[model samples]
Target: MYTLAIDLGGTKLSAALIGEKHDITQRRELPTPASASPQSLEYALAELTGHYQGKAHRVAVASTGIIANGVLTALNPDNLGGLNHFPLQACLEKLTGLPCLVLNDAQAAAWAEYCLLSDRFRHVTFITVSTGVGGGSVIAGRLLTGPHHFAGHIGHIQADPHGPICGCGRTGCVEAIASGRAIAAGAKHDLRGKDARAIFARAEQGHLQARQLIARSAEAIAQLSASLKALLDTECIVLGGSIGLAPGYREQVEELLTRLPPAFHLPVYPARYRHDAGLMGAALWCEYCAT
Candidate 1:
C-alpha cells in the first residue's frame, strides 16, 4: 500500500506519494498560509492534498511544532505565528479519509537518519536549523518521543540567559540564536531585513558582518551539540534544514566543536535524506507502527 506523506513546515507545506519501498512520487509544495488561523491551514492542506485523492492507503504527517495527543502547539510563536493548539491528525484524517500518524518534523527526521545509520550507531541525534532550531534523539536504537511528546526540543534549551528573548517566551534559547529566523532577526545595517539564505550568500562574498552572524549561529549550534553529547552520549549528530545544510555550515559547526574538549566532540554528518527526511521518515514510521 502507498502512503500520503506530508511535511508541514513553518514556510512551506510539502506532500508526496510514497510507494511501498518508500520512494517518493508526485511530490508537491505550497507556501504555508500566512494566516495561522485553523481555517487558513485547513484550506491550504485541502489544496495541497487535492491532487493525490484516492492514491494512498494511509497518511503520515511530520510537522514543525509540539505534537501532543494529535494536536499541534507552536512552542515558538515567531515561527508558527497563530497556529497554536491545532488538531493536526484529525484534520489530516478528515481531509484524506485515511488513518494517519503525526509527529514532530525534527523527530521524524531523526527517525529517518537513525534508520539510515542504525547499523553504524545506536545513539544518534538529528538537528534542523531552519526557521527554528529543532532536534530529535534516538537512544539504543529506539526513538524517544517522550511521555509528553516533547523529547528532543533542544532548541528551547537555554543558550544564554542574558541574550535576547525567544519566541517561546524564554531568553537566549538556541533557537533564538541559531535558527535561520534568529539569524535574520539579528541582522543590522546593510544586512538588515535579509533572510538567512541571503545573509549566507553575503557571507560567501566576504561580508564581515554576514560572516560573524553565521559564526554566531554556528557557535550556538556547536554548544548545543556539546550539551547533547554530555547528556545523551550521542554517537553522532545529523544536521539538516536550510541553514544546517548550507554550503559550509556543517563544516563551520564541526570547526567550532573542535575547540571544545574531546569528550564533547562527536562525528557530525549531513542528513542523508536532506529535504525529504521528514516525508520519508513519517511514511516509514507509519509502516513500522503497522508492523
Candidate 2:
C-alpha cells in the first residue's frame, strides 16, 4: 500500500507520496504559515494533503514540536503557538478522511535511519543538529520513545550551565551551543552573511573567527555524543541535519569527539537519508501503524 507522509518543520511543510518500498512518487513543499495557532498550521497541512487526495492508503506526520499525552506543545519559531494541546491526529483524519499517525520529528528520523543502517549496528542513536539539536534511538530494532513521548528531546540536555541561553530559556543546553542557530549566532560577528551555509563556508575557507565558532559548536555536539556513549554504550551515533552533514563539519566533530575521555569512544556516522530522513520515517510509521 502507498502512504502519504507530511513533515512539518519550523520553516516549511513538506508532503510526499510513498510506496511500500519507501520510494517517493510525488512530493511538494510550502513555507509554513506564520501564525501561533495550531489551526493555522493545520490549514497549511490540509491544503497540502489536498494535493495527494486519494493517492495513498495511509497518512503519517513528523512534526517539530513537543508531543505529549496525545497533544502537541512547544511549537517553535513562535509561529505555531496555537499547536499547544492540539489534537493533531484527529484534525488530520478529519481533513483527509484517512487514518493519521503523528510522531516527533527526531523519532521519525531515527526510525528512518534505523531502517537503512540497522544491519551495521545493533543499537543506534540518531541525532539531528539543525535549527535545534534533537535525537532518537533504536534499540534492538525498537523505537525508544519514553513515557512523555519526549524521549528524543536531547537538545535541552544541559551542556554548560552558564554558556548560552537557549530559546527554551535554559542556559547552556546542547542546542544553545551546537545547533545551526547557535552556529549562525556565534559566527554572526565575523560572517557578513546571515545564513548557516555562509558561515560554514567562511569557516571552510579558514576564516579565523568563523573557524573558532564552528569548532566550538562542533565541540559541544561531540561532547554530547561522548556523554551519550558513556551512558548508553550504543553501537553507533548517526548525525544528520543541515549543519551536522556539512562537508568539513563532520570531520571536525569526529576530531573533537576523539579528544574526549576514552571511555566515551564510539563510532560516529552521517545520516544515510540526509535530506529525506523525516519523510521516509513518517512513511515507515504509516506501515507501523497499519500493523
Candidate 3:
C-alpha cells in the first residue's frame, strides 16, 4: 500500500507519494502561501492532493504548527496570518476523500526515525535543531504522545531565564537561545547580512564570533540532552535538521555532554535518515494509525 504524505513547513509545503517500503515515488513542493488563512492553506493542500487523487490509498500530514486535539495553532501567528484552533485533519479529509492522519512535524519526524531504528534501539529521542528547536521521543518502542499530544516540546524548556523571547512568547527557551534563528540572531552583527550558512562557513574558517556562536548553540543542546538523559535514559538520541547536520556540531555537542556528571551518559548521534525523515515518518504514521 502507498500513502500520500504532506509536510507543511513554515516556508514550504511538500507532498510525496510514499510506498510501503518508505520510498518516495513522486513528490511536489511549493512555497507556503503568505497567508495561512484556513481557506488559502486548505486550497493549497487540496491542489496537491488532487495531483495524487487516485495514486495513493491514504493520506497523512506533518504540520509545522502545534496540534492539540487535532486542531492547528500555527507557531507564528503573525506570519501565518492567524490560524488558530483550525481543524486541519477534518478539513483535509473533507477536501480529499481518504483516511487521514495529522501529526505535529516533530512527532512525525521522530516516528520516522523510530521506525527506522527501533529494531536496534529500544528507546530513542529525536531532536531537530534547525530553524526552530523541537523534539519527540519513542520509549521502549512506543511513540511518546502526551495527553495533549505535545510530548516532545523540548524547545520550550527553559534554557536561559533572561534570554531572547521565543515565538511561543516564552523567555529563554532553548529555541530562543540555540535554534538556527537564535544562532543567526546572536551572530547578526558579525555576520554582516550573512545567513546561517555563511555563519557556519565563517565558523569553519575559525572566525571568532562565528565559532563562539556555534559553541554556545552546542552548549544549549548539550544541556537539554543531559536533561533528557536524566529523565528517559534513552538508548540513543537522534539529531536531525539543517543545523544538526553541520560538520563538527555533533562532536561539539558530545564534547559538552561529556562535561556533565559521568552518570548522564547516553550516545548522541545524527539521525540515520535525515532530509526525508518527516515525509517517511508521516507515511509510517498512516500505517500505525491504520493498525
Candidate 4:
C-alpha cells in the first residue's frame, strides 16, 4: 500500500506517493496559493492531488501552523496568513475519499529525524528556519504535541524584546529575527528588496551587508538553541529548511553556539531527509497510527 503524503508549507505545497518500503514516486510540487484562504488552499490541493485520487490507501499531511483536532491555525498570522479554522483532515478526506491524518509540519519532521537516530538518542529537538522559524521535540522517544497541539510552536519564543514585531502581534519573536522571511525583511540598502535566497547568494559573494544579516539570523538561532538546551536538555538539535541547510548556515549557527558555555552545546546537524523530512514523517506517522 502507498501513503499519499502531502506537505503544506508557507512557500510551497508538495505531494508524493510512498510505498510500504518507503520508496517515493510520482512526486509533484506547486507554489502555495498567493492568498492563504481556505478556498485557495482547497483548490490548490485539488489540483495537486487530482492525478493521484485512488493511487493511495490513505492520505497524510504535514502542514505549517498549529494543527489541533485536525484543524490548522497559524500561530503567526504572518507565516500562514491566518488560514481558515476548518478541519483539514475532513477536507482531505472529502477531496480524496480516503482517511486522512494531519500533523504540524515540524512535529512530523521531528519524528522523521528522530526515527533516523532512535538508536542513538531518545530526546531530539528539530528546528526549521525557512519561511518562518518553527520546531518540534521528541522527549524520551515520544513526539510532544501537547494537549492543544501547540507544543512545538517554538518559533514564537521571544528573541529580543526590542526586535521587530511578529505577525502574531508579539514583539521580538524568534520567527521575527531568525526566519528566512526575517532575513529578507532585515535587508537594507544594497540588499534591500532581495528575497532570502538572493540575500544568501549575496552573502556568499562576500557582500558585507548580506553576510551581516545572515549572521544576525544565525545568532538568534543560536540563542534559541541555548534556550532549548536549558529547557529540554535535548540530546541533539536537528536543523532543517532552506536557510538552516544553506551552505555554511549550520556552521554559522554552530560557531555562534560554541561561544556559549559547555552546557549549551549539543550536536547541531542538518536533517537527514533534508526537504523530504516532513513528507516522510507524515507517511511514517500515518502508518504508525494505523497499527
State TM-scores per candidate. 0.94, 0.93, 0.95, 0.93
Q: Point out the higher-scoring one by lDDT: 2 or 3.
A: 3
lDDT of 3 by residue, 94-206 (tens): 87788888888898899888887876898899999998899899888888878877789899899999899988888999998888888888875758666678899999989
Candidate 3: how large is its RMSD?
1.6
- The C-alpha stretches of model 1 lying farther than 4 A from their native spots are 77-82
Model 4 C-alpha lDDT per residue in residues 99-199, reported as the tens digit of each score:
89999999999999998999999999999898888889999988999999998888899999999998889999999999988999999898889999999
Point out the worst 10-residue segment of candidate 3 by lDDT.
74-83
List model 1 lDDT by residue over 233-290, tens digit each: 9999999988999999999999999999898999889998988999999998888899
lDDT at 80 for candidate 4?
Answer: 60
Model 2: residues with Cα > 4 Å off, grouped in runs: 75-79
Per-residue lDDT, model 2, residue 191, is 79
Candidate that beats the other on TM-score, 1 or 2, i.e. the better one:
1
Query: All models: lDDT?
Result: 0.92, 0.82, 0.84, 0.90
Evaluated with lDDT, which candidate comes out highest? 1
Clashing pairs in 2: 35-79, 36-81, 36-82, 37-82, 38-82
Q: What is the C-alpha RMSD of each candidate to the true structure, in Å?
A: 1.6, 1.9, 1.6, 1.8
How many clashes show up in model 1?
0
What is the TM-score (0 to 1) of candidate 3? 0.95
